[model samples]
Target chain A: MARDTAREPVKTGPDYLEVRLGIYRGMVRVRYFEKRAYDLFLQNLVKGTSHLAIGQEAIAAGVAAALRPDDYVFATYRGHAHAMLRGAPMVAVMAELLGRENGLMGGKGGSMHLTYTEGNFMGSYAIVGAHLPIANGAAWSALYRGTDQVAVAFFGDGATNIGAFHEALNLAATWKLPVVFVCENNLYMEYTPIRKVTAVERPAADRASAYGLPPVLVDGNDADMVFETATRAVGLARGGGGPSLIEAVTYRHGGHSRADPGKYRPDAEVAEWLAKDPIPRYKERLLDEGVAAEVLERIEAEAAAEVDQATEQAKAAAPAHPGGLEREVFSDGGATWRR
Target chain B: MTYREAVAAGLAQEMARDPSVVLIGEDVGAAGGVFKATAGLLEKFGARRVKDTPISEQAIIGAAMGAAMTGLRPVAELMFADFVSVCHDLVANQVAKARYMTNGQVSLPLVVRFGNGGGLRFGAQHSQSVESWLMAVPGLKVVVPSTPADVVGLLAAAVRDDDPVMFLEEKALYPTSGEVPEGEHVDELGTARVRRPGKDCSVIALGTMADRALAAAEQLQAEGIDCEVIDLRSLVPLDMTTVAASVAKTGRVFTVEENPRLCGWGAEVASIICEECFYDLDAPVRRITTPHVPLPAADSLEDAAIPSAERVAAAIREGLG
Candidate 1:
């Protein structure tokens, strides 16, 4: 079957105005949400560890915008932005960090494991490359059941070194499972730089040929580029072209977590990445694209207000229920299941 | 029917009953499993449900988790229990905790079946029993069935269970045949049965150890020391009701295990016996298990390393003395 070209999201296409604006709005919301979450974490309101995808918003916003609502998404620990851009309610996202009952995962998962099953988002995994094979399996389930709903796994550059990454890609391609492996190359594996740990000159895209899959690269800072690459990959998998790897060359502007200040990163490198910050970069592009300054400013104001309201609602929400905590040990959700 | 056939029968029954039930492993489909336990399943169910996966334990288990989360009852087969070391993260961290961490929004209806134990002399690497490793994991239910009938019924129940279940099938007992009951016989998870009842002493056993204990009890009957042999089919949801009742009746208890002595699951049973049935016991809970040592290759050395009927009888005689 011929791949559906019209399904791809284009920046300069006839629908550019609405498409670009949606991407721009999502990036802004993610930026604001991460900042608000960090500020709340400072006040000790958000418990546990939180990994903010602050500067890497374009990848999440762009990749999420490329897929259908029924398509499955599995992301890593740095998944707040990924969850939000996939249409997860900001209040629920914030509630999860606050350990409230109204959180995305009933607060049992806290910040790291936020899931929106209704949206087909499988949520974030703390273990680096753990979700890769799982994502392949979800795609296998879709294929086994004869559905075209492709699955996507979002991970960082560090995860590419893990054994699971090799195993998942190998199995996914070998079985022709309908899945996309998206590597958000944020340049650092926690405090250590990727270059210091990675063996090759670049990430292992050259090795993808072993799995009978294509290796594609895109500018992570450019939302339109990410969208285009992801759209093409998702389409290929849906059309039975097997799996694909999309290397989104990106950077994270903050510390590894809430505690580290990232002193290991040189000032020139930090300044270099900060200048490529997707939100401001895209906002400038929107203004240059002839969208009125007031219109862009209004979108920015709305994002801030929505995040502020979500923060307040999250703070006021009740704590997660303690009753029947024992029953959570084993699943009671399904005694007998069928497709 | 044989224990191996029972495993295949249970899997076939479940797959025929539910369209979502699938089997994934190395050589499980075309090869009909390494032990031929899944013999003819591929031809019956087709390759889609009875999948022959690459030799990747992580992918096999991880894919099962994903399939289960998205509404498939996946039965993943590991070639051996020792390879669980390779699939540990997916089982211990991912599949086991998903439902609880998600607060019941997700369910993992998955069963992991693997061949375990050291009696057949496959040597140290392939012959180790690792049920204690899985028993410590909270979200997992560990099961070990001795008889062919019990293996058939236990597997059906495990396939239907919502939680992740580890079904350890002893390699030596696969060819052993017994009178298996008719269809739709699903045994409850936490139930135990008294193989042979007596009043003077209670012999608690798990998996193939139950066979040895029963043999030992028969020999003890000739010696005029009455013994009650009990088969503990499930480990995680231990049948303490039957254990306590037996202990109360006999006032003497002995635990026979194939696993090593140190920190074995038998420790938990002994501790429970001490706590709940302390007044009912006339003797301290005696454990007849393999000594703390890695199993060597020679048949004689391997036999010495593991518990036998004679070894168990010795422990019983010592306890009675």
Candidate 2:
């Protein structure tokens, strides 16, 4: 079909512009959610220091979008974006940050330990690299029960050096498990730059080669690239081609936690990365490909409105109650009444 | 039946009863575990359910916790309790805290079996009684079975429980023969068993030490002093009611354990007895435990480190007098 070049680019495949536009919306939602979380931290509404995934939204958006409802996903402490993208209630996430009765975990687990088991987002682990092995176990359970369900573990660049990461990769490769290990290489492992501690090169795949699975490298800023790569990896895992690794190259725009400024990162490096932020880049791509600019603006405005309402509701909600503190401590009728 | 056979039978029964129950550990499948506690399981359950792993303790326990959370009942084996140190973080933080952390949204229906205690010349690294450390974790239910019947029932109960159970099997008592009741016997975890009836003193013990306490009680019976022997099957819930009743009747109590005397479960038991039934006691409760030293590799030194029946009897005699 012949189309006007300025508005609709010729040869835009079926659903091409629509898909990119949706991804742009997801990235915008994550950015707004993270910005509000940062504000909540400053006001001390958030119990502990919140780790912001400000610049790493595209990875969560792409991977979660690629997943099926039953497919499991385990993310690290920097996991707000992942949960948000998976459609967890924004008000519950906010209430969890404020440690309220209506929070995701009833205020039991705060920012770093959010869990939405019904959504199959098992948790966001506080410990680095610890959740990888659990992801492997979930994959093994799926395989044991003769299901095509796959498990995905989302961890940071620093987790690659830990023992759990190495053992998990080895076990997954050995058992031929259906899992996708995504390393969000955001340049810094918390405050320390990954280059200082890591022995290998930029792509984490270099290390995965030792475990017998070749890793896929993707431009984490571009959601289209990440979505395509993650979909292919998920396909292989479901079809019993064993586990695969994806090294997503990205950068974090915020500090490791609330208090310290990321002074360890050079200003030139910060400015350079800030210029390529995924939210704006993805938005520009969608608009250039003949997607309406009004759609992008509406998505941003809606995300801002939703997040503002959730924040106010969370901050004003009742704090966690002290009654029945020892409930659910152990199962099978343990009778140690602490009253 | 031997304790080893009881464990295998219990696991087999649970795995057959519930398809979600899975066994994962090193050498647990074809090798049938280091102590043969899992013998014939791989043949019955197949490799997927009765799986073997590398020498990765943390992965073994962590994966069990993971599997349990995702709707599988997992029974993981650590060859020795000493190796649990490697999996401490997974047990203490993840498996123990997951249900509470998630506000009851998730339950770890998992059982972690460890071959615990000393008297075997496995050296200091292999021969630690680690109940002291595992007990400090709040959400974990700790159980140590002395007899084969208790082993079978407690193992079955652990598989059924929604939370994590630290099912510590006494390594030295695995080969000891006993009449374990057949056909679906389940032990209520925190119920203490009264092995002997007496009025002079109450001798409370756990795991293999229960046998020693019985032997000590028998020796005291010859000296015209009667002793009631209590076997505590569970540690966390701690069936102190049975203990308090026995102490109230006997008017004297002695707690026995194989772990070190300094900061041990024996002291916790002694403290509980004092707190609950102190007025009923004729004398201060005594704790018979190993001196503060790592279990040595030599047989002579290992014997010296843990309490013998003679030592247990002596402590009971002193308390009764």
Candidate 3:
């Protein structure tokens, strides 16, 4: 089993307190946005399918807080939280889910492929384990250009068994590229439990030694611990200490997608994870740390209001125009294959 | 210059001109290349630019896509065209659709070069023409160079272009010598070159089949049959204008293909010819391709499987009749 570093006591200081509040606010924003997305999906406002990160907010929030503004982030389909935390406009993200012309990708990407280049959130890949090597490529470019920028790739625990994951890790370790691979071990891969399919108990961390990387596992539910682990990993990568694989053990609150009710999971397991929900746990932590209840309430209210505004704005936007179908396929701004 | 030497020269020319161009693949550094096509590049460019990666095609192509997304213009090589299946997701799904999916948020200015086609009896796994596989995919520029000159010029063009290009080098033609243009040689991507012009029939081919078509055209000329040989340098940016014009003049068309008969690149060309040049064509657009089966290891069987000069001439002559 990977070492549990979630038991470390929270540090106390004015600066630390401020950072903690920011992390908490980020988590709240994600929780509200995801819940709104769920509602939107139910109303048929969200097209296709959406993977919600309702219970897995801390990994995205903590990792985003640890990264620099210019740092690149490559995320998977379940990436609303990652994109929002990296400063992607909430309205644009909502519009993308709604498949609107004013969406992040002009409705071309939809929910699974949200990309805000301005925020350095490179892209959200739909294919499993596809973006890991691409993340290495971004890190390689930074190294080649003599920039201190690092690339971070977010994937699920299921990605550990895929060939691209192993291939990416080996290549990153070999080249010593400035990249951080974070695995949000949300207990399940789609509908099935990851442990039932995987050979090892700790899917990602156990494979670290094969690539000459140290096994670093942390509690995905604790924003403070994830932030600290991410900060160290990001600093090491930026300083040319090579790639780091961090297995963040967490659980998903709902099913895999809008379609799944996730009834395959035992009711007891679901109840247990719901009780340890990161948002309420962190709020309790803040209250216990001598922080005012009004501040926490204000953050929650602000997050809810932001989600509400974004929802309205997305609903008002028009569907993508059919005339622009052949545009932007090439750098020439045309999809013509023949002369 | 030999076709193989032109590969290195084209890479060197681009690397010298553009500081952003970097080469990465398995055994591409100190070991030169498996086919020596990338010889002397490591010595000239140094380790920072010329990198040797592990045997991971997914990582190689993925890294190339990632680097291209950021800033660097990466030229990645998969040892064999057949190996594209190993990293098909990166090629077909990720790299191909990324630009369009992101609504042009990212531009993939990269090249994936691979040894393609069968002649040396490498059998099913190592010997396969994959141009047809990529032709079906969108957002990819497919370049198949027959001669050394086209290899050098087209490669330079592919590197400079701000889109993902699949540079398929016919491995059999690597030893064949041809005159390459000196200093900065860049050819247009979508244009087809008419190697031999005629009035009786239009013989269209790609990569290795282009040379065979030219040979077939020469053979048919002595028998009172004038064949127009059109070499399709780039498949994606297909020069249908040139093809349509040739078909109008000749009134007869035949496609020489190395890929299997089923869903080959020739099928697309045939469909286009029938659609646009149906009235101009005197006969049906005949596609003389390899049989729909895995390439055999035996010399005679492999030779029989792939379309030859005789087969192309016979098909055109029979069609013209």
Candidate 4:
């Protein structure tokens, strides 16, 4: 397969082109969903902070595509894209953001904390690298049980420096458990740039060698490139090739969360990344192929309509509060009841 | 089956039943664990299933959580219960809270088993009973089984449970023999069992302390003081009703725990008893527990730090007097 990087767009695997196209559509769904979420935040339709997965949807769509229904996945706070692409009902994801009873978590987890068990998206952790150990534990269990299930943990560049990331990687490497650590290196940790946070600058995947694991860096913004790399890694893990570290090098187009306007980053830096938007780049590739221009427009329209429906469903979802919060704690039958 | 044998059996049986239940910890595969709690696991399940991990608590727990969340059931053995501090966040914050925080989306279903409390004189670092600290966490289900039957029953229950469970098997009780019924069994959390019923007083005990309570109750029975001994099998979901009912019936209560006295597990039970059953009590609730000091290295000093049968018998008398 030739690498498509011209008027014909980037060369993709001809055999799996539809698979790539399907994933690209999922990416567009996430892209538009996040954009609508941002709009809702502006209108105060959502509560708490919304972590935008903008410019990073390709990573979620690509990685989640290769995972089995029973496989485990853990993500950071900016996890709407991961949850949605992993097959979490769009209604619940939107309802969770709206803090409604019909949400995936019944409104207990608003944005940073979202979970969908049916899709195997275990949770989107609010605490930086804390989910690393949990993901490791789940993978360890799968390997122990003799099943070839793999656990995929997603985090930002800032999390790489935390003790949990180091500890999880070291243990996963030592035990040779089936786990994949995908670091969405979006250049900045909230406001501080990656260079200012850690001494390592090449890519987050470079640190995998320190733990004796196979590490790879890929073009995070390209949906086809990300899909190919993730599929290879997922295949290797399911085949008992131990664990791998994938550093999807991309950029976050928005601020850290809903609160910030990203004033710290220069306008030119933002503009440069916007020019390389994942959705448009993939659309260009499809147009160059036999895909019709009308089809492209139809897909965009469908994605927008889906996003609008999810938003409306979220707005109409019921409220869940103290009662739902009390159910998951302690297995015992009785405890204090907060009215 | 002995408590130790029961644990090994539970692991072996779970491994055979589910392809997703894996046992990993230091010395767990070949060495059969430090306490020999996993004697034939490696041979029966193979190295891939029964793993011996490096001495990294954080890594071991983190990996276990990862495995469990991803659709596997991981049973991790921390060499000693005292070592739980090394990976407290994974248990308390991550594993314990993940399910609740995620609104019941992720169920840890992870079993963390280890020997707690002192009888072998391993000193402060290795002998501390820190189950109380874990009981405070909301998402964790704390199970401290005293007998082989309870161990087998509770182990099965914890394995099947969707929430993260902390199964604290007392080091002293592991070698002690007891009858565990054949086949699979399960015991629910937060239900206290009455070992020996009496009418005069309630002797509340947890873990190995329940054995001492039974001994004391037998001795006190000869002395014409009938005592009802309650074994608090689970701490997190405490059966306060049983304790309160016993206190209401006898009008006197004596609590025993191997852990220290100050801010210990006993304090929580004591407070609950005083709050609910104080009106029916004839005497103040007395606790026979370890002193507010680190577990001593010397056997004699260790004896002083931990509660004994004699100490429990005397506390029962004090409460009766």
Q: Estimate each model's TM-score.
A: 0.96, 0.96, 0.98, 0.88
Query: What TM-score does chain B of candidate 1 reach?
Result: 0.98
lDDT of 3 by residue, A65-148 (tens): 888899999999999988888889999999999988889889999889989888989999999999999999999999999988
Query: What fraction of correct interface contacts does each candidate retain?
Result: 0.62, 0.55, 0.88, 0.67
Best by TM-score: 3
Question: DockQ for all models, in order?
Answer: 0.48, 0.54, 0.89, 0.46
lDDT of each: 0.87, 0.85, 0.93, 0.82
For residues A1-339, write the lDDT of model 2, one tens digit per residue. Answer: 111111221126666556666677778878888898888777777766688888888898888867888898899888888777666799999999888988988888888888888788888898888898899989988888887888999999999888888888888989998899999999988888898899988647888788897757999888888888888788788878878889999988988888778999989999999998988888777778777788788988998999999988888899987763656666532336221
Inter-residue clash pairs, candidate 2:
none
Q: For model 2, how does the per-residue alpha-carbon lDDT over B1-321 read when each residue is reduced to its tens digit?
A: 999899999998899899999999999999999999999999999998999998888788878977887889999999899998887878898888888877887788899999999988999998888888898788888899999999999999889988788999999998899997868887777788999888888889999899999999888899999889999878876888888889899888888889987888778778877887889988888889989888899998999889999989988777666
Q: How far is B32's C-alpha from truth in model 3 (Å)?
A: 1.2
lDDT of 1 by residue, A57-103 (tens): 99988888888888999998888988887778999999999999888
User: How far in Å is the alpha carbon of A151 misplaced in model 3?
Assistant: 0.8
Per-model RMSD to reference: 2.7, 4.3, 2.6, 4.3
Q: Give the TM-score of candidate 2.
A: 0.96
Winner of 1 and 2 under DockQ: 2
Tens digit of per-residue lDDT, candidate 4, span A210-240? 9986568998898777876777776676667
Model 3's lDDT to the true fold? 0.93
TM (B chain), model 2: 0.98
Question: Which one wins by DockQ: 3 or 4?
Answer: 3
Q: Higher-DockQ candidate among 1 and 4?
A: 1
